[model samples]
Target: MSQTIDNRQFRLARRPKGLPERDDFDLVTEPLAEAKDGEVRVAIDYISLDPAMRGWMNAGKSYIKPVGIGEVMRAGAAGTVIDSKHPDFAAGDKVSGNLGVQTHAVFPGDELRKVDTSLADLPVYLGALGMPGMTAYFGTLDVGQLAEGDVVLVSAASGAVGALVGQIAKKKGASRVVGIAGGPEKCRYVVDELGFDGVIDYKNEEINDAVRRECPDGIDLYFDNVGGEILDAALANLRLHARVAICGAISQYNVTGNVGDTGYAPRNYLSLLINRARMEGFIVFDFADRYPEAAREMAAWLSAGELKHREDIVEGFDTFPDTLLKLFTGENFGKLVLAVER
Candidate 1:
């Protein structure tokens, strides 16, 4: 008898009102389909959980089209190709891409990139070696236009990308690197473990006051991850011609009310004018052609102990909804990923 395989997926059942709820997603299982010509069957090992996933759930236009109701929730994942009919792929090859929230998927081989397990663990590829790494790399160096001896400040300091931004800033010869993260524990980790020059416990300290003290010399570059009050604080401390990389605005992700009504818009626009600063937003996909070059340099940093990486991996495909909720709550530390195979 031939073997029978099952495919499980977390599909968007409805648009989320705020933080995604259980009913927003539907878990469904079906028999795995065979790989057809020009297609490959991937046995997903892990799924990435990112703050931007929230934006993808909204009803309207954005950088990427919103996940329509009933579609498999969009995600970047890593897995092994179990069956292949395309020239570029073969069975047993490990690959990563927008694999969605599923345990098994049959896709055009062109949609995947082969990953070497010897280079990094599969989950790490979904974190430091994946989109997060690419985001940090270009956002800091290219978008922010960093300079040696510059004072750098990055929000969401202990997170997957933010953690790397601070470290990369320091490596690139920033005179001071200050990280703004929630709570004392994350702050300590940012400074002590990640080698940030200083850290602000944003949950406890007055954000504006913290930024003022931490960047008394003025912020030369600000790699912002959590916009809102944090961006306001960073704005107030900018030096002349300072550059700000708008990496993400996770602080506003779960707002159930009108996104405009949140009243979190920067009140310090005058600072930008006064300081002649520049602020630019970027998407990692914009730099996809150069990912291999960035990955090589980052891999060298990782191997040399100059760059630090972290992840918060949770098991169980059935727990997808609850696990995704953890990103908004900050319940999962580091780069959040799902161990889909379990």
Candidate 2:
């Protein structure tokens, strides 16, 4: 007999300006059918909430197509397979993929990866061992071209990707790992807990002043998460032959009106020419073939206690809209996950 399940989903109700409100999404329940050929039906357990999701909502050009107005809000999710017609997957297997925001997903088996439950928790797959982890790894190593003893600085240092970037730099023998975050608590976490060399609270101190004080010798590698003013500040303090990995620009995601020309323009563009530095932006999906290698190394680090992860799990699927706002507002700590089922 075929099984039918009621799936709850959040759809994009409207485009948002600044911080997204509850009205941006509509939650509705629908009946889900059995999986088709080469597909598996998954009961989604954990859904990842990322800062990048904000960019996906806007009607603009990007690495991927914007979510259509009536479409399900795009997301990364981890869950257990309930049914499968794919030869590679089976019932009860744990899988992770871009399943969007829903209680149930019919995922293409080719797109899903089987996860080892012994390595870490399910939320870890959506966070430290998933897209955020891979982003931190490739962006720092390939884009930033990090080397031993290089001084590394990261903005949004308390978020999922930034936290891992700092830790990975430390593991690679970085001389100084400095972080810039929003408040005292986050700053403290980056330094005291995450083993960063220093931290600056952007809320209290000016961005350039903060960078100047912490990175006196100039920054060799800047893993930029929050661009805008922070990027301009880091540009002014680049060391010779420095590399900047433009991972994201969270600061400018919330403007309601026209994205004005008044945004922070780096006054230190000459620094790149003077120091022979390189700046590059990257998407994690570009390194798809290399994910296994990254996952192996990151998993090893996690098992060896060299890598640490933190998750901010929000309960209730119905609160998806409200919960997503936490990332932009700095209310979420570590990797944010929403638990849809028990």
Candidate 3:
């Protein structure tokens, strides 16, 4: 006789029209089944909460398919393998992948990647060493084409990706790096804690005026995480031939209405033409083949104490709905991660 295990999951109940509410999800418990051949079973420990998750819940065409109603909500998670019927993985191995929002998950072994937990904690893989880290790496270096002595500006500077973007710019020899964040505490953390050259408190300062004052030499590179007014401000102060990397637009993720109607589309886009600059959007998945290259370098930086990372972990799997709202409310100070209460 084998021991029985139960799986707890949050299934999508509706396509949210605005910010997602608890009612949009159906929390259900079901008995876990044994893994089939070529499959592995994992007990999820940490789940990533990103603004992109909001976009993934909507009904539409996107870089990835939307989570169908009644399906387990899509998520990136890290966990330890508890059972494996595959040759590549075994019990006790740590792994990370699109494990969905569940206490337990079973997937084809090929869909999961084993992570070196000796180098980083399981939750760190969901932050600085995970998707956010990769996004910052390629978005800044490849798409933004960061160059030495360039003055860089990044919005949502205290966020998971934006924080790394600013630090990477500085470490790569940017002359100066300025950040824009919502509150004084976040602004201070961006500059005092993260070593940004300067920071603008978007809550207190006029975004346009602050951007002009901070990047007096004009911005050579703008790493945009939160779009809308911040992006427009960055555009208005671009240096000659500057590059703008459109990463994730957290500011616009939850807006309702037609594509162009609800969110604030840039009013200063003409600045791109005037400055002879380039603005391009990139998905980190596009650089999937080169992830090892980025991971190795980031790991080295972390070990060398040259890179700083933070994770705002919330305990309890049942708190998923309210916990996710923290990202939109600017309450999460760093990378938002949900840790399953053991």
Best by TM-score: 3
Summarize candidate 1's per-residue lDDT along 1-342 as a digit string, tens digits. Answer: 327788998899988887889999998998888888999999999999998888888887578888889999999999998889899999899999998999999888887889878868889889888999999999999999999999999998899999999988888999999998888889889988999999999889998898989999899999988889899989999999999999888878777523324447888978889999998889999999999999999988877777888888898888889999888777777999999754
Candidate 2 has an lDDT of 0.90
What are the lDDT scores of the predictions, listed in order? 0.89, 0.90, 0.91
Q: Where does candidate 2 have its weakest 10-residue lDDT segment? A: 256-265
| Global lDDT of model 1 | 0.89
| TM-score to native of every candidate shown | 0.96, 0.96, 0.97
- Residue lDDT tens for model 3, 80-127: 999999899999999999999999998889989999987888998998
The stretch of ten residues in a row with the least summed lDDT in candidate 1 is 254-263
Worst 10 residues of 3 by lDDT: 254-263
Q: Which stretches of candidate 3 lie over 4 Å from their true place?
A: 257-262
- Backbone atom clashes (below 3 Å) for every candidate: 0, 1, 0
